[model samples]
Target: MDGDFWHGNPKCYRVPKSNVEYWTKKIEGNRARDKKHTKTLKRLGWHVIRIWESALRDEEAVATKIRAAMMRHINGETT
Candidate 1:
């Protein structure tokens, strides 16, 4: 997630909303839909890692988590 940039107002940012809100909005599926999809993927033997936008706020931690998830997926650790 990128940092907000100051608008013409000098105080207000040009973005529409916080990163969390933006992601939540972008992920349009309902909670039930997500649960079903996750369950299906898990049953199909996949490592499903869902990272929230807030997690990316800390670049280092985000990189670590992403790397770990990718490694785990590549190693066939799940199902």
Candidate 2:
């Protein structure tokens, strides 16, 4: 699970006002690292599922999405 801010979710992430530059760089770095890691995992033949922290509020919805992703993966769908 990824925290919205830490993962730099564009939907709802803002750099802290106290240290704008630092936080911006930090979050940007985190996002870059996340992308790199995900790419590596995919290159190694792993299905990557990233669920945001906020989305965890709805367990049923998350489960359905996961199931759908799993089904797509099983069906050799590149998603």
Candidate 3:
């Protein structure tokens, strides 16, 4: 799971008036790193499940997603 702000959530991120360029670059870097890491992990045969902060608002939905992922992994369905 990742924070909406720190992970560059398109729905939640708003550039600060002060130091706009710096913040934009910093957040963009974070997003790039996250994408790279997720790709690397999947390449290494890991089942990467990314949960957004906003998704946590629905506890049941989050649990269902997690459970489904786990089931897939256990059943050798996830790559």
Candidate 4:
């Protein structure tokens, strides 16, 4: 996910006081949708590797993870 707020990051997201219910529902829906999509993709034989927004803060770690996933896929190890 690109955004901490929309993706429901516990350490970063806080519902706005002005419209608590609306924000809560919106963020929750986003999380549900993300989960559903990831599950669907995996079921369809996709290697779904989710890199959180916070992980992007460390460029080297993100690159390493991507490389590892690619290597795994190349080795026919989807799991």
Candidate 5:
């Protein structure tokens, strides 16, 4: 599911949501939090592959990308 920033805000400009939320501004350490969350999920045996909000623009390519992630997850290749 897409977020508010991706859906309308022009500032986002082809950036991933993670990049947008965590990497934007020097407000705080959102990036580090994201890293922690990802690591936590991975440690819990969850395959967590993230796609950029812009990547969804191409439906076919997005499908392929998601499928690849799923394949990797199924194959037990830790993300």
Candidate 6:
């Protein structure tokens, strides 16, 4: 599960008033590293599912997303 804040959730992400630059860089670095890791995982033939921390609050939505991913996998779609 990815932390919404760290991964820069478009819905609820905000840079802190204090240490704004630091937080921005940190989150950006995290996003970059996450992208890299996701690429590596997919290259190694892993089905990647990124469910945000906040998204987990809505169980039905999460389930639907997972089910969609599963269907895509069963249909031999990889990304």
Can you write out model 6's per-residue Cα lDDT over 1-79, one digit (the tens) per residue? 9998989987899999999999999999999999999999999999999989999899999999999999999999875
- lDDT ranking, best first: 6, 3, 2, 4, 5, 1
Model 2 segments more than 4 A misplaced = none
- Count of steric clashes across candidates, in order: 0, 0, 0, 0, 0, 0
Query: Which residue runs does candidate 4 get wrong by more than 4 Å?
Result: none
- Pairs of residues clashing in candidate 5: none
TM-score (C-alpha) between model 3 and the true structure: 0.87
Total clashes for model 1: 0
All candidates: TM-score: 0.48, 0.93, 0.87, 0.85, 0.60, 0.92
Residue 33 error, candidate 6, Å? 0.5
TM-score of 4: 0.85
| Candidate 1 TM-score over all chains jointly | 0.48
Q: What TM-score does structure 6 among the candidates reach?
A: 0.92
Tell me the lDDT of model 1 at 1. Answer: 29
lDDT of 3 at 53: 96
Question: What is candidate 2's TM-score against the reference?
Answer: 0.93
Q: What would the per-residue lDDT of candidate 2 be over residues 22-64, giving only the tens digit for each residue? A: 9989999999999999999999999999999889899999999
Report each candidate's C-alpha RMSD, comma-separated, in the order given: 9.2, 0.9, 1.5, 1.5, 6.7, 1.0
The alpha-carbon lDDT assigned to residue 78 of candidate 5 equals: 56
Residue-by-residue lDDT tens digits, candidate 4, 18-39: 8889999999999999999999
Best candidate, TM-score? 2
lDDT of 3 by residue, 1-79 (tens): 9999899889888988999999999999999999999999999988999998998999999999999999999998964
